[model samples]
Target: MKLYIVRHGQTEWNVEKRMQGWGDSPLTQTGIRDAGLLRERIKEVPFDEAWASPLKRAEQTADILVPDQQIHVHEGLKEMRLGSMEGKRQEDLHPSEKKTWQTFWEDPERFQPNGGETYGEVEKRVNGFLEDISRTSSGNVLLVTHTVVIKLLINRFEDRPLRRIWEPPYVHETCLTIVDWDGTNGKIEVSCSIDHTKAGRGW
Candidate 1:
């Protein structure tokens, strides 16, 4: 089966540079337009199933991209929980919080959020979701999710260490990552491609 893992479109939090993990935000007009462009790009592919994160941003993107389909909302597809960091900008974080945020980008394995989930934890849950789909579905599957979730899935597919999760080619809004799953393993066909949108690179 082919997995079309897509990050949700740009949101209010994205423009504000705020921590949006597990937080909710409405999509910007550009975001909706980008998703529409992507929809036109991939409308020919017959998706057997559609899945999405429970977050409103992801759900909205899914709705815009596949309005004819019923999206199966799954908690495991949600973004990494950011706890107290949600809805706050990095500059607004306390000194210690700022340090943790830095660690998250520089040394992810050692980084710990105030009350958020660890990378390993997010990996496990997202992997479980993958396992469920691999067993129950076939053909093309669309998964609308967040940046962190997309990165973790890529790490799992590439078998990369948690420390290297923040590698290059950052996941931009509404970017598509295609994976060919052979029941157990996934091979990436495309990684963070936003050819359908006019948005700049980086998340």
Candidate 2:
């Protein structure tokens, strides 16, 4: 099976640099334009199935990317719940909390916010969702999800440890990452591509 994974477009919270886990903000104009550009880039893929997080931002992006297809909303694809940190800017965190937050990203399996879901929890749900998709779908699949979820998915496919969650190969907004999975194994074809969002006259 071939998978096309896309991180949702930019939101008001994204521009403001706020924590948006479980919370939501509408897409910016640039976000819509990027989604449109992404649509054009992947229009010829002929996806047989599509799935997206229940969040509106991801749902909206999926709709734009796969106009006529029915996108199944999966709770497992939702962003990590940030608990008390939701809607707060990184600068707003207390000095101690900020240090822990930074550590949480670097070593998610060991640290987490007071009320947030742990990395292991998110991994379990996402892995279950992937297993179901692999079992039920036979052709190309498109998934529109959050940044952290995309990161976790890539980490799993690449056999990287959870401690390196914040490592290189970032997942950019509306960027495409392709993976080819054959039941027990998967290969990354494209990591993250922003070629559709070039600054030329006609991108």
Candidate 3:
């Protein structure tokens, strides 16, 4: 099956480099425009089913991209809960914040901030959603979500360390990740994919 993993456009939190942490932040004006452009670009492809995170940013993007279609709101697709760090800029975080972020990479299983959910906690839920979707034989599926969740999902399909998967932050508004997962049913072996950020077609 063809999986289209897309990151939602810029939100106010995104521009501020704040950790949205499952918070419901409205999309920025730029975000709305980006979602609309994505609509026109993706309308050409025959999307069979739509899946989205329940967050407003992701839902808004999904709605603009695939209106009139009933969205399967998957709770497992949510961004990791930041607890105390929600809406706070990384720059404003305590010195321990950097250490915490680094610790998350070293060991996701037990790392946690004041009230932040560990990466391991997020993984379990995200994996459940992915397993459910992979059961399907064939269809075009789209997941509009936050940056951290996007990286986490990619890591699930491709065996890589969480920190490595999150090493890059070049994803712009309306970026698309084309992932190919076989229906063999157990684990996915990724063959090829593209980052449309560099595509110079005014997308």
RMSD of each: 2.4, 1.5, 3.4
Tell me the tens digit of each residue's lDDT in model 1 across 1-203: 99999999999889999999998999999899899989987899999999999999999999999999999999899999988899999889989888888988999888779899888788889989988987799999999999889999888889988888999669999999999999778899999999888533223
Tens digits of per-residue lDDT for model 3, 1-203: 77776777778888888888777678898778767766766777777778888988888889988997877779888888877778788778778776786566576655697787888788888888877877763677777766667777667666777657655544566777767766433233332222333343454
- Model 2 residue runs over 4 Å out of place are 199-203
As a whole number from 0 to 100, the lDDT of residue 167 in candidate 1 is 92
Model 2 TM-score relative to the real fold: 0.95
Model number with the top lDDT? 1
- Which residue pairs does candidate 2 place in steric collision? none
What is the lDDT of every predicted structure here? 0.90, 0.88, 0.72
Model 2: lDDT to the true structure? 0.88
Q: After superposition, how far is residue 140 of candidate 3 from its true place, in Å?
A: 0.8
Better of 1 and 3 by lDDT: 1
Q: Which ten residues in a row are the worst by lDDT in model 2? A: 194-203
Between candidates 2 and 3, the one scoring higher on lDDT is 2
RMSD versus native structure for model 1: 2.4
* Per-residue lDDT over 106-193 for candidate 2, one digit per residue giving the tens place of the 0 to 100 score: 6677777768888888888998898888779978999999988988988888899998878878888998899999866789999888
